[model samples]
Target: MASFTTPDGVTLAYDDIAPAGEAERTVLLLHGFASNRSEGWRRTGWYGAFERRRMRVIGLDQRGHGESAKLYDPADYTREKLAGDALALMDHLGVRRCDLFGYSMGTRTALQAAILAPDRFSNLILGGVGGRLLEPSTDRGSIMADAMLAEDPATITHPFLRSFRQFADEQGEDRRALAAFVQAQNPPLDEAAMAALPMPVLVVAGQRDEGAGDPEDLARVFPLGKGVSLPGCDHFSAIPHGLTKATVFDFLDGLLDDPFEGRF
Candidate 1:
């Protein structure tokens, strides 16, 4: 468990895993809402894949989740602040640049970071993101936002009851803690902010994402970016595997040569 104090003086946590042989590239993995580093991409063998590619992987836990500093204030969970935390960690670790892989909320933060500091990253892999998340404000969004702030574990867990119970039993994540964490961390980004990001972005999303941001909508955001729709995958199932992993690696390979190229 390593830690860094952000510019805001909040402590952030991260796990650094180095490959056995010579390192090729470094990858920073960011997890989604209500989840930590180990629970999201790390469990999917992404760290191992990076190891196979001789890449050093950094898995970070966002504030208020995992072992990071828990600030219960909702205002502290804004997108700008979240992105700043990543940069602050990078500064602490002496990393000039690195590739980023962010899933769901993590991806949103990654987008903001790339926009806020365009030169901080070599490339980006955004999973489960396609467009502005705060748009089309619905009654459902308000309800979920309130339920999240209220810290109602039952209502939060009802959708993933079986999975949540199994995860708690297996991984020791307190459902109530996660529920409260998720409920309080609802930050929305406006369209202008979303469109300002500059990078060669790769957007990957599940074909069936339960009425979330449409894949096509996300793909259209960056004129030079490419979007890929994962077949036979729901949100969780779209994780890079087999051919999918190869696809991402190929994209990363190209980007490593020319990180600023907007074309996929």
Candidate 2:
């Protein structure tokens, strides 16, 4: 239940888990939208897996989610601001460098953080995201916001929106705050920024996820990146899938063995 105040004065909640043995490395876990650290990482068995690898894990509840300070204004949840919160947490913990494993919405934050401070990360594992990283797409924020505001989930017409509302309700999340968060849309990271990344990266997505786009195509954009597609999984289902974990662990293990194994 530890917490830190961002420069913007938002109090973000986080959990710091020590490695099972002498710490070999540190990993920062970023959860997706409308999801917290516990549900996204801890309950998904991510914390234990990392612990088994002797990696210290730091999972944070992004602003307006989980036990952190919730703001009603959409302007407060920008990508830069969210990224800053993560970097600030690292500084607060005195961790000079670490690896980043971000899923879905969290992937955007991690990418922005890496762009903001490339030297701060050794490797990056981007999961549940793909081709959307390259091109600008329709903003679904309003739809999601509308879904959150809906009085009855059954009344929501759009299947995507309705599903999100149902998940939020099931999780008992703060709908108003999440609605505001949706309003605070993240700016596109663009290909130029990703292509220039110097650290090793792995792009992962479910083969059947429409939102994920083409992971192989997305990976090609990064100078030092590779892609892995999990079979029979969608964006939501991919997060907790065994294949996703295996791919990430394999990529991370490779990094541990030789940080520049595949680099020219």
Candidate 3:
């Protein structure tokens, strides 16, 4: 793993694995909220799958997560700030363009990045995201933030919200940093801007993932978008599932057969 200081002075940790091929295809990975690059992508079979495909893979541990610098200020985690860091990493690595993959919180960052600079991206893959991206995220952030900072995990009665606290505890994440991030205010998603993007996008979600809503709805918003649903999976299970990896691989290889291909 290597570290670089962003223009804003936050240090981020990342891994760059290059494939032994002429094409030198590149893909950038952004992990979910409480996850690091190793746990979110490497241990989840993503690294091996991309290696087998001979694609150059770059994964970043976003600010306040993994080995990256932790900041207790909510303002430090705004959508624009996270997006700036992502773009900065690309520039720091001298990567003009690459395929991008992100999940959950990562999805939000990826979306803002693509919107900010569509020309620097080829294909955009959003996992564990759906129509919820179109809604206001302020409430969601506050709810998760409260759950993360709760004095006792047992007090978080909502099963879905409680899961985050439990996962953070299990991962030994910095609760104060995670709490600030979970409650950070990100600019509401701009669907109009998203629809104008020229790159082909794949929105993938689990069939049982209620938090994501319908991937097809989000997919339709993009001019060149497609949605795929993985059976027998939920939000967390969707990311590391074999089916999820296969679907992502198929889409990346241009072998995907979307269920709602032309409807969009």
Candidate 4:
């Protein structure tokens, strides 16, 4: 575990998982909304995969979440600020370029970072990147209602939610704070804005993604982009599936060469 200070003076936390030798390249893993670095990748077994593959892993706890500062400024949670934290993490580590993998809310941050820095990332692998955040669709909340209602809402939302709630219960990070963060948050970009990103991109979606349009809508936008579906899975379950795992690894493997040069 390592801690770095952002330009904003927030002491952000990151977990560095690497093999003994020099790192081939770093993959920045960003977690979803209300999730922290450890819960993001550590719990998912993805971090273990990266460690076995000999790749350096930089897992971040986004502002206002996890062990990082929990500011309620709302501005603190914007895509711009989230992406900035990524770059700041890299800068602090002295890494010139690396790949990025963001899931759910983390995916939006990945896209935003690639657009803003353009050159800072070699390739982008976006899992559960549904589409533009600004586009309104009723699908997201409705699909999960049945499942959420059936199960304890927090546990179904994420495995660590129960533990997090317990931590927040003792530490005083209220459920209202989490709810307010979600309500105040909106997708930061539209399709046109996303299309302008020049980096090689991969958009993965769940077959039953309720919040965004179907995978076809997301795939149609980026002809150069590869789209794959996780059969029988929704937004949260998609990434851990066999199909998504194969697709993501294959895509990242292909981008390991010079195309990763700081082009955008």
lDDT agreement with native, every candidate:
0.69, 0.87, 0.89, 0.68
Q: Write the per-residue lDDT of candidate 2 for residues 1-264, one digit (tens) a residue.
A: 899898889999999999756899999999998889999999889999889888999999999889999899999999999989999999999999999999998998999999999999999989998887677746688888888998878899987677778877877889999999989866677568878989889999998888888887888888988887777899889988887887888787774333234632
- Give candidate 4 misplaced runs (Cα > 4 Å): 131-134, 137-176, 183-190, 255-264
lDDT of candidate 1 over 1-264, digit per residue (tens): 888888888887898888887778888888876678877767787878888898988988988778788775556777788889888888878888999888886887888888788788888788876654546544543344444444444555446343444444455554444444444444455456546556667777776755345655775666546677666666666765553575578778764333224545
lDDT by residue (1-264, candidate 3, tens digit) is: 699999999999999888776545889999998888988999898988888888888999999998899999999999889989999999999999999999988988999999999999999999998887787655777788889889989999999989888888877888889989987765668889999999989999999999898998899999989888877799999999988887787787788876435534
The segments of candidate 2 whose C-alpha lies over 4 angstroms from its true place after superposition are 255-264
Expressed as tens digits, the lDDT of each residue in 50-156 for candidate 4 is: 87778999899877667777664545566777789999999988888998988887887887888788788877877775544446645443333233233355555
**Residue 29 in model 3: shift from native, Å?**
0.5
Residue 47 Cα positional deviation in candidate 1, in Å, after optimal superposition? 0.4
Best by TM-score: 3
Q: By the lDDT metric, which is better: model 3 or model 4?
A: 3
**Angstrom error at residue 262, model 2:** 21
TM-score, cand. 3: 0.95
Compare candidates 1 and 3 on lDDT and give the better one: 3
lDDT of 3 at 135: 72
RMSD of model 1 against the true structure: 4.9
